[model samples]
Target: MVTATALEAELLELAGAVPDPELPVLTLRELGVLRAVHVQGTDTVDVDLTPTYTGCPAIEAMSLDIERVLRSHGMREVTVRTVLAPAWSTDDITPEGRRKLREFGIAPPRVRDGSDPVPLSLGPTRTIATHAAADPDPVHCPHCGSADTELLSRFSSTACKALRRCLACREPFDHFKEL
Candidate 1:
């Protein structure tokens, strides 16, 4: 692992502070996409960024934002490289980010053990039950805090989120899907 110099760390923070284009509520750092920043020369720097998923549409905007932020911070040249290896996962999201998402009326992705296989509910939405015993970690409604929620659609406003409806409050919300 490479240790970051004080200057590099400061630049990283500036880059990380850039708000995500798709999710304005969360910064790139909170979203866990801003990987690292390396100073290449006196005024040039290179940054590593990972997308939430492969071919994420917001990547270009994210790169541009990072470059703009760095340039304004006195960086003569800034390059944002998207790295695919060590894929980005929902688990990478920080606790603060999750809380912000929930406060923003979006259900945050649940934490999971990477080694374990995810439990799959294969039955029809209406027939399936969301019992506590059945689903230990049910996607609770961000609005009413109810576990009684059903998936309305696999895709929502963005590819990363899914549309879900809370049976209790009769409200629709987006749930950030576990990557």
Candidate 2:
């Protein structure tokens, strides 16, 4: 007995509850991926979401999660749409999302000065010896809040993150790599 307006509102609320599959701390809205929500009649809800990265494996899981959440609320014929025009960036992450990420044991993306060098390296000579210096800005440890961290692996449980350990806290955490 729900009106179209009420159904749309309910669907949005359910969508808001569905977190990003890869980054559980961020919801689709917080990630700036939930572009549009439309109520196609009474039983159908259309959701527009942009993928964080091209060919991201999490997209499938996220779409499924959205559908599941909507269906639980008695929404039938839920349609999850993917859009990729503008693309996603760390800047798209809201302040609240950043706070959540930090609390969830992942350091938020740090703003970098353009003067840090294009390759973030001196030259080919240094690049051959050490790839470490090539990183423009050092990633801070999420646990200890220290800059003294080392990259353990380029890819974590998810492809979008890198595994790092805090030298001070001796704790391992994920770092959202700069794309």
Candidate 3:
């Protein structure tokens, strides 16, 4: 007989392997969206997830993907829950995720130092991270592999990306802004 712990481990592995709909380059584990996977009983699995941002439209799709992946793998009664506290940070993105982001022509965020640059504050007593909303850091060129890039706009095709133009290759690309 398979122990609950072992079953849960398998379930977690399966669920964590599901890729994000918006960020197809990274899996839930690579994105650090997967928080916890616990077995409540012999047949029930519970999962905790956090979104990249509060208004991220991909949250619903991610949740549904998690459930679908688990069910297709023969697991039943899987529950995916999202939590907002301890807010998600770009630091949560894995090193693999960073590599994948770069491979996709989108520069990944720099290593986080516990200081996030998000604009909104959860509430009083919460130290809100300050981002350079106007002029952002100089982004590197993912095309020609040069650091000579100029920030065209702080916003990109997605809320998490910044538009940049490479001076060397004269190519335009998006930088995955670190949150």
Candidate 4:
């Protein structure tokens, strides 16, 4: 006989394993999108999720997937809630997600400490200064593992990714933007 607590544990594990539709290479756990999972009652479970973007279409897919996973496990009443407060930040992405992004030929958002140096310049120089902060951290070339890279476009195939070209490997790739 499976204990309620034990079942809840299993449910949590299963929910964590749900994959993101946009970034199929990473699970919700790695993406840090599964906020909470707990047993609501004898036959009920509740799941809290934070979407990468508020308007992200992937959220709907992910919510449906979470429900499917729990219902498949025999949960009679499953609730997948979207939590908008403390909105999702790229920093929320787990280290595993970062690694997966790199493996998938997408550079992960760099961590920011708030103390990163900001340059002061005006006129055309302001454009250059802002550009420097566009990617506050080093954008390593996913193809050749070199730090030499250039931002080809602020937009990519997805709203959250920017297009970048690697100087070393002369390859183009998407960079997961920082929130």
Candidate 5:
């Protein structure tokens, strides 16, 4: 028989399997939203989550996904609690999560150094610049690896991303804006 701790671990693993509704390529873990998992009893599991953004519609679906995954694992009495304090940021993204985002064709958040120039190379340049909304970076095209990407629209399919087109590849794709 699995101990309560073991059951909690299993539930966490299952929760990690549930992808963010907004970013299908990213799991709740990748988004740093799955805060904690606790086993209330032999049959009950509790999960704590933080939303990526306020008023994000994905939270509803995320809650449903958590409940569904736990139920599928035979944990019928499951509760998902959401916390709002200490707002979420791209800095909360784990290294593995960043790697996943890169593989998914969305550049991870740029770490700024207050005055460092924006990295212009796709092959690892070491400089940072503030990614303020008023001073957006020259986002590279994820598909063709071109620094010659231009913002097609400030809004994409989701609020977290922007639509961009690669001048070299001539491909339109979504760029995860720095926030």
Candidate 6:
């Protein structure tokens, strides 16, 4: 495995600290977007970032924020590159990020494993344990912690999320869809 120099590490931390434009509650690091930071020369650095998904409009904002941060921290030239290889996954979200998402009234995407059963959300309280790799896990309401929720819309405020209403709490919220 490659190791980062102290300066690179520091720069990485700074770049990762920038907040996501869409989900302001989580940092880029927490969202697992800031991939790496490499110091090219004395005053130049290159940063690799993966968006939450392809064609994410927020990538430009994230890049600007990262560049501004690194430039202010003594780097003369900062290059933020969008990396598509090893596409970003919901599984990349840190545990803390998931917690923050829940706290912010968004249902975090359920973690997935290849061995796990196919999750199919039949309804707010219905489930079908089939062999299909669908989202079978119930999107619990973050406010009331109730599994009784209904999808109001396939897309929420963002394309990456779904709008849901909790039957128990009668509150509407967004669910970060699994990617």
Stretches of model 5 off by over 4 angstroms after superposition: 1-4, 112-138
Q: lDDT-based ranking, best first?
A: 1, 6, 4, 3, 5, 2
* Best of the candidates, lDDT: 1
- Model 1 misplaced regions, further than 4 Å: 116-129
lDDT by residue for model 6 (1-179), tens: 88999999999999989999999999999999999999998999999999888999999999999999999999999999999988888888999999999999999998888634434454543223222234366788999888877778778899999888887778989999888
Which scores better on TM-score, 1 or 3? 1
Candidate 5 residue-wise lDDT at 151: 66
Write model 2 residue lDDT over 85-147, tens digit each, in one string.
Answer: 777766667788878888899977765545342232233321111123655567777787877
What TM-score do all the candidates reach, one by one? Answer: 0.93, 0.75, 0.82, 0.83, 0.75, 0.88
Give one clash count per candidate, in the order shown: 0, 0, 0, 0, 0, 3
RMSD of each: 1.8, 5.6, 6.8, 5.1, 7.5, 4.5
Candidate 4 similarity to native, TM-score: 0.83
The lDDT of each candidate is 0.90, 0.74, 0.79, 0.81, 0.75, 0.88
Residue pairs in steric clash, candidate 2? none
Itemize residue pairs with steric clashes in candidate 5.
none
Lowest-sum lDDT 10-residue window in model 1: 123-132
Q: What residue pairs clash in candidate 3, if any at all? A: none
Which prediction has more favorable lDDT, 3 or 5?
3
Off by over 4 Å in 6: 115-136
Relative to the unseen true structure, what is the C-alpha lDDT of residue 89 in candidate 1, on a scale of 0 to 100? 85
lDDT of 2: 0.74
Candidate 2 vs candidate 6, TM-score winner: 6
